[model samples]
Target: MSNLTWQIGCVRVTRIEETLTTIPLTSFFAAATPEALAPHLPWLRPHFVDAQDHAILSIHGLVVESQGRTILVDTCIGENWPESNPLERSALLGDPTSPFLGNLERAGFQRERIDVVLCTHLHFDHVGCNTMRVDDTVVPTFPNARYLFARTEWEHWRAQEDPGFAATLRETVEPILAAGLADLVECDHVVTDEVRLEPTPGHTPGHVSVRIASQGKEALVTGDMAHHPVQWAEPTWGIAADSDGAQATRTRQRILAQHTDDDLLIIGTHYAPPTAGRLVRRDGRVRFASG
Candidate 1:
């Protein structure tokens, strides 16, 4: 994992990159074909997207430092731990060895010192590192911290008919609950003066985005609210992973409408390197502008 960190006023956000990979644009965005992405090539190339139209995605977690507390936003795929489904598996490289714990300590964060763990949603990838294997059993990675989960998010995945998602709930989430370490919270619950969880559903029934404001500066940690930056270029474009496309579009619109400027720093959980940037209104449409 790469130690890429950014600061937003009094709060500092660091990217504990799990893995960086690419997938075809056609396969990534449901409404976009390779042909449709052609026009946006000049702006997208060599950074967000590549020559073959693959969208670059980084699976990682964000460490939010504020108010003398260390909070981990999302945990990435495990260090030596493997996953069952394709979604979780693809985020890994062959014999993936991104020593998650080693990297965390190297970044000056002690696992046992993490005050809280916030999962934006209960997708397999986002919650993979919630627990780490200990010889024969899986256990909560951060033994001394409280894990914050959205109540609706927990029930949504637990009742999923898809076995893959169900397996995810069993593997990644149940362990936390079993340990008496989870604190199921509502979507609008506040974490701190600078960090708050706000519903941005659509990717899932209870999806959320984190809002951070400090000293007149602001930032939004977008948890899959919009996967690729290209979506800002074409709002209609979307991904198949979304459980509710219409709702997701509305949520994406809401984000772009509010923060398409420098005043709000938009931090993407899955965007490639230099992942944190801002959006802008260009020719009546929202566009991804460097932050």
Candidate 2:
């Protein structure tokens, strides 16, 4: 619930945090071991790492408001999910005891007031809050909002047989579809004048990074293309969850190339504190300039 807000002309963006966790670098990036992170430790510590040398990541919700529409990008992990879920045991451990509804309220975003809900992919943390538990039944958290999803992304997960992910799809995604609130859209679909989806797949088959531009400023809300700032520095690192490491690396490099040596703010979906930053070029290498 930090007072984190960004303004880009007529657009306003805010972060409603659910939890912060420190996990092994290898958990996400297979090549980013403790020894590999040794040189970056000075810059990464005190904010992006803990005493135990684990990399820190946050799970939160981004509230974007523009043109009389309030949109939420990626609902953080909600409580009441099954314990057997691997993602729940990863780092933060099962939603971190927060009531997402109250966090949204504290962020000045009422559940009913949300005009649209966009999921970058069908991942557990990204879609956990899509529904809420009312008594014993799960239902749409944003009763009036249209849940926008990439048709390809939906179909990929929908055709899967994994019990854990399927449970997440059942409770978090299917309920919205059953309620007739789901809007399956193209990967590049536009949400508002200043906001639109940019297909940056590979982490998931239909992954996308959101772009926001207004006046002369711009920012990218990276869904899962690059989960950490270090990826910008070393684009070849492989992420364990990515379906295709080569494709994910390509997407990461593409985004880095666009933001490096520019003013584009890159807001990482799971980046640690001061989560929003810009990519810079130094000595022909990429560096992160925090906002």
Candidate 3:
């Protein structure tokens, strides 16, 4: 468990970590190269990047407690992918013994207590824990929660024929729908008065970042809109998993421009320690200043 908590006005957000590891820059960013990343290494090192310059990625779920609602945003990779799974074999290597549930409990969020399970988009890592195996059958992990999926996002992935994504969807999302626990909603569906979906398409056609506003304070839970802090300065750099790289870049530019120097707390969904920060202009470029 990362055990990181942030208070946005009256709402409480907790980070329940699933995996923290270093990924080669090239493996994550399509345009990343030693020369292209060298300039930003000075500010990115010791946190966002390791000594070897690999990108430090944290796979975690953000639990938002707002308006008497315990809404979980983006369930991290659960304990389901087997070694023989195609995605596990090629990209992840093997199934991880993730302590996600135990950590969630320690963070004081019980599975049945969660009122809503919100997925930004239907990706393997983001939605894996939507279901878990019990007695050789996969079932909804949060039996009492209403699984929220952006209608556009659900439609896109539901029609996808890609083996890796299809496999993940079958394991994680389909079961929830089968159980009648899913609510296919619009991109900007409001989860609560303090928390709502902010449509940030491009990573996927319907990818939505979480927006939290309470008592005049505000924060944004970035859902792969900008994965690494480096994107603060290099918004054009697209992740390899992006469904549309050009659109993703445009979305980053628009969101970054809106939040730059605006005092809005930007909580990265994949950032390492000190994941929450504010954007500022430094050396004529936007930089994420962790507080």
TM-score of predicted model 1?
Answer: 0.93
Model 2 agreement with the true structure over 82-127: per-residue lDDT tens digits: 5567455344644356556688897778898999999999998899
Q: TM-score of model 2 relative to the true fold?
A: 0.94
Could you tell me which 10 consecutive residues in candidate 1 have the lowest summed lDDT? 79-88
Query: How well does candidate 2 score on lDDT at residue 116?
Result: 96
Which digits, one per residue and each the tens of the lDDT, describe model 3 over residues 204-240? 9999999999998999999988889999889999976
For model 2, the stretches where C-alpha displacement exceeds 4 angstroms are 83-91, 94-96
lDDT values for all models? 0.81, 0.84, 0.87
lDDT of 2 at 270: 90
Provide TM-scores for the models: 0.93, 0.94, 0.95
Better candidate number, 2 or 3, judged by lDDT:
3
lDDT per residue for candidate 1 within 1-291, as digits (tens), equals 357787878999988766778988887776687677777777677788877778888887899988987899888766424355754564453345555567778888888989899999987668878887789788898999889999989888888788788777777789899999999999998998889999999888888889998998888898987888888788767787888988888898887777776588888888888887788776675667754
Error of 1 at 239 (Å): 1.5
lDDT of 2 at 175: 89
Highest lDDT scorer: 3
**Candidate closer to the true structure by TM-score (higher is better), 2 or 3:** 3
